[model samples]
Target chain A: GAGVSQTPSNKVTEKGKYVELRCDPISGHTALYWYRQSLGQGPEFLIYFQGTGAADDSGLPNDRFFAVRPEGSVSTLKIQRTERGDSAVYLCASSSAGGYNEQFFGPGTRLTVL
Target chain B: AQSVTQPDIHITVSEGASLELRCNYSYGATPYLFWYVQSPGQGLQLLLKYFSGDTLVQGIKGFEAEFKRSQSSFNLRKPSVHWSDAAEYFCAAAAYNQGGKLIFGQGTELSVKP
Candidate 1:
C-alpha cells in the first residue's frame, strides 16, 4: 500500500507570500497530523485531525498558519505572509484511529522562505 | 505540557560499534513513547513504540528501546551500527487525550564512520 505522501518536494518563495502545502494520508487512516522541523531541531507539532475536523490545533504557532482536512483524507497547510522563520520541512503523518497507533509519515515538503 | 528531550545533539561512532541515544520526557502520567529516524531529504520512519507490556521493545534495523517509568526515559539503542544508520533520530511522546498528536524532542544526529 502507498504510504502518506506530500506534493512539491521543495518550494522556494519570497517572504510575505502565501504558500500552501498539501498532504495525502494513507488509505483508511482517520488520524492525520502536521509538524514542522527546523534546522538542527526536531519536528514540532502543528495540528491534528480526526475525520474532517481538527481534533487538536494548539501546536499551531499563530493565526498566520492554518490547516484544513476536507473529506478527512487530504490536508492542506496554509501559511499567510510567510516569514523567513517559517522556512523548514513540513511533515505530515497518518495513523489508524486511536492514540496508541504508530504514525506513518510522508516525505516532507521543504519550504524555504527567502 | 508534555515534552520530550533528546540530550545529544550529534554523535559519531565507528561502524560496528554499539550506539545509544538518550531521551527524557516529562508528563503527568505514563505516556506513549516512540522513536523515529529521518534521513536527509526523506520522511521520518518509525523505529519503535512503547505503550505497555515489557519495557524493552525491538524495532527495525536492529534498533531497540527501553521505557523506564521511574527515570521517565525511553532511550534508543543498537548493538552495532552501520553506515546506513547515519541519520537524525527523534523521540516523541503523546498522551491518551492528545488525539494522537505527538510532542517531539530536538533530534539527535547520528554519524557512522567507516
Candidate 2:
C-alpha cells in the first residue's frame, strides 16, 4: 500500500518569496498533521486537520504559515515571505482516525530559504 | 502540556554490542508512546508503540521497548546492533485527548562502529 507522500523533496527559495508544499496522505486517513524540524531539534507541530476542516492550528508559528485540506485527502502548506528561519524540513503525517492510531509519515519537503 | 525528553543526543556502539536509548515523557495522564527511526532523506518509520496491555513491545528491525508507568519512561533497547542500524531515533508521546498530535523529543543519533 502507498504511504503518505510529499512533493518536491527539496525546495530552495529566496528570502521574501512564497512557497507551497504538498502532501498526499494514505487513502482513508482522516487525520493529517504538519510539523517542522529545525537543525539539531525535534519536529515541532504546525497544524492538524480532521477531514476538510482545520481542527488545530495552534502549533502554527505565525500568520505567515497556512494550510488547507479541501477534499480531506490531500493537504497543502503555504508559507508567505520566506525567511532564513523557515529553512528546515517540513514533515507531513496521517493517521486513520485520531486517538491511538499509528501515524504514517511522508518523506518531507526540505525548504531552504536563502 | 505533554512533552518528551531523550537525554542522549548521540551514541556510538561497536557492532554486535548491546544498545539502549533513554526516553522519558511528561503528561498529565497515561500517554501513548512511540518510537520512530529516520534515515537520511527518508521519512519517519515507526519502530513500536505502547497504548495499553503488555509493557514490553516489539517492533521492526529487531527493536523493542519497555514502557514503565512508574517512571514515565519508554526506553528502546536491542541486544545487538548492526552497522546498518546507524540513524536517528525519536521518542514521541500523545496525550489522551490531544487528537493524535505527537510531542517529539530531541532525536538521538546512533552511530555504529565496526
Candidate 3:
C-alpha cells in the first residue's frame, strides 16, 4: 500500500512570509500527526488529528502553526509570518485508530526561511 | 512535562558489532514507548513500540527493544548491526490519552565504521 506522502519536498521562503505544507496520509488511516525536526535533533510534536477534528494540539509552538484535516484524509499545515527559527523539516505521519499503534511517516517537507 | 532523553549524541560501531541505543523518559505514569529510524532525505520510520505486556518487543529490520519500568527506559538493541544501519535513531514517549501526543528525544547518529 502507498505510505504517507508530503508535498514540496523542499521549500525556501523569506522571513515573515506565509507557507503551507501538505500531507496525504495512507488510505483508511484515521489518525494524522505533524512534527518538526531541526538539525541534529529529533522530531518535535506539532499537532494530531482524529477523523476530521484535532485531537491534540498542545505541541504546536504558537498560533502561527496550524493544521487542518477537514475530510479526515489529507491535511495541510499552515505557517504564518515564518521566521528563521522555523527553518526545519516538517514531518507528517498516519496511524490506525488507538494510542498504541505504530505510525507511518512521509518524506517530510524541508522549510527554509531566510 | 513529558520529555525524553537520548544521552548518546553519536555512536560508531563496526559492521558486525552489537548495538544499543539508550532512551529514558519522564512521564507521570505508564507511558507508550517507541523507537524510530530516519535516513537522509527520508521520513521517520517506526522500529518498535512497547505499551505493556512482555517487556521485550521485536520490531522491523531485525530490531528489538526492551521496556524497563524500573528505570523508566525503553532501549533499542540489535545483536549485530550492518553498515546500512547507519542513520539517526529517535526514542519517543506518548501518553495514554486519545491525542497520542509524543515527546521525542534528541536523536542518536549511528555511524558504521568498517
Give the alpha carbon lDDT tens digit for every residue of B1-114 in model 2: 678999999999999999999999999898999999999978899999999999999999999999999999999999999999999999999887878888999999999999
Fnat of each candidate:
0.94, 0.81, 0.85
Candidate 2 lDDT, A1-114, residue by residue in tens: 999999989999999999999999999999999999999888998999999999889899999999999999999999999999999999999999977899999999999999
Of the pair 1 and 2, which is ahead by lDDT?
2
Residues B1-114 of candidate 1 have per-residue lDDT tens digits of 678989999999999999999999999999899999999777899999998999999999999999999999999999999999999999999897787788899999999999
TM-scores for candidates 1 onward, in order: 0.97, 0.97, 0.97
CAPRI accuracy category, model 1? high
Q: For residue B20, what is the lDDT in candidate 2?
A: 98
What's the alpha carbon RMSD for model 2?
A: 0.9
- DockQ, structure candidate 3: 0.78
- Quote the positional error of residue B62 for candidate 1 in Å: 1.0
Instruction: Provide C-alpha RMSD values for all models, in order.
Output: 1.0, 0.9, 1.1
Which residue pairs of candidate 3 clash? none
Candidate 3: tens digits of C-alpha lDDT, residues A19-87: 999999999999999999898888888899999999888879999999999999999999999999999
